[model samples]
Target: MAIALVLVLVVVGSVLFHVLSPWWWTPIASNWSYIDTTLVITFWITGFVFSAVVLFMAYCVYRFRHKEGATAHYEPESRKLESWLTAVTAIGVAAMLAPGLYVWSQFINVPKDATEVEVVAQQWQWSFRLPGKDGKLGTSNVRLVSADNPLGINPDDPNSKDDVVVEAADLHLQIGKPVKMLLRSIDVLHDFYVPEFRAKMDLVPGMVTYFWLTPTRTGTFEVLCAELCGTGHNFMRGTVLVDTEQDYATWLEKQATFAQLSTPAKVGALATPAKDVAKVE
Candidate 1:
């Protein structure tokens, strides 16, 4: 009787604590509310199963307690019981998985008017690239990576000349504008995650992966690396600022284009050597 009472109390206490828990998810800032809905569904289904199983165990223990002169019966060949257990378990699992599958389908299909933004990840840093007046990002080549051309933008491409390159800086997005984030890793693996946004994806080397989100509010959000690449993974943080339309335009105007940044490097490369200058003199 005491054991059964304790089991019942455990279920009741757990449910009460979950309902009144002070710690909960952060307020969502993006359009992934369905993710939260799916989570709640999972919790409800699992909680129900847990409560039922534990209560059943308690009832069995109390009702079948060894009586003073009771003899143990051994008749354990009930196909009906096994079949019922199997069916219930299958139903429980399917109920949990169905919502997640539906949400995942919506996650992958981006809107037609969404703008593209490239996110470059290294072992310990985050960088971003935005389309220029041409409204397109230029092709990139790993071989072209150097001190002057860190992002490896193809200099020969006319489309690349105006691309806005923001190296290890805060990324600003205009509020309510849908953006498709293109993720790439120059070194090991990384993940771009913002808690408020509630969406994240992996950054793989030699391949580009992507996801989309629209900034529903204007504020500064901390960017964290969800993957542990190395020792510095803990410090690999960045900032994302969601701004109004005029503020976003002002920030963009202050950023230098690929051509503007590469001009000095090109000039230095084309400069005549000191020895050649003396010979010419």
Candidate 2:
């Protein structure tokens, strides 16, 4: 009796906590609410199965409790009952898998007009690159990186020369525009996750990964690194600012390029050969 009462209280308390909890993924802001709905469907189906099975077992335990001289009865499986249970299980699995695959399809196929942006990750920091007047993004490589080559910009590629690189700055996007993000990591694996967008993808070193989302609401959102990179992993945070077209354009204009920021005086000083200069003097 005491054990039963304790179990009842525990169930009630857990239900109340689930219902009253303030914590949850930031309220769905995109069309991916269907994902959440599908998840809830799975939850319900699983919960029903677990509760029904346990309660039925409990009922059998109480109803068929060993009474003095009570005889035992054994029977083989009933075809009708087994068939019904199998059918129910199949239906539940179908219900869960169908919607999940549907959502995954949508997540993979990005619209043609979606704006493309690149996110570059390094040790404990995040950077971004946006296309300029041209709609193409230039290629990059880790081997070209050095103190002089901050972004490892492909010098041979003319298209990369004009690409705007925003280092250690908040990424900006225009509202209602589908944005496709290309993720690259310079060092280790990291995850680009924005809870409000309901989407995320991993950034693997020496490879490119991608994801797409359209921001329906205009606001600043947090960009968190979901993968464990190093000791400062928890501090790897950035911001995503969604704004109007004009605002986005204004923000884009403020970004400076590697060449533009490099001073001719400094470049000449670094490029001068020591032996040639000494002979000239």
Global lDDT of model 2: 0.81
Candidate 1 residue-pair clash tally? 0
Best by TM-score: 1
lDDT of 1 by residue, 152-183 (tens): 88999999999999999999999999999999
**Could you tell me which residue pairs clash in candidate 2?**
none
Q: What is candidate 2's lDDT per residue for 1-281, written digit by digit as tens?
A: 44444555555565577679885568765556777877788877887676666556555666677799999888677899999999999998998899899888998899999988999998798999887777778788989877766667776776776688888889999988888999999899999998888888999999999988888888899999999999999999999999998998888888876455444543354577876545544
Error of 2 at 95 (Å): 0.9
TM, every model: 0.89, 0.85
For candidate 1, what is the lDDT? 0.91
TM-score of 2: 0.85
In order, the Cα lDDT scores of the candidates are 0.91, 0.81
Model 2: residues >4 Å from true position, as ranges? 1-11, 75-81, 258-281
Q: Which stretches of candidate 1 lie over 4 Å from their true place?
A: 265-281
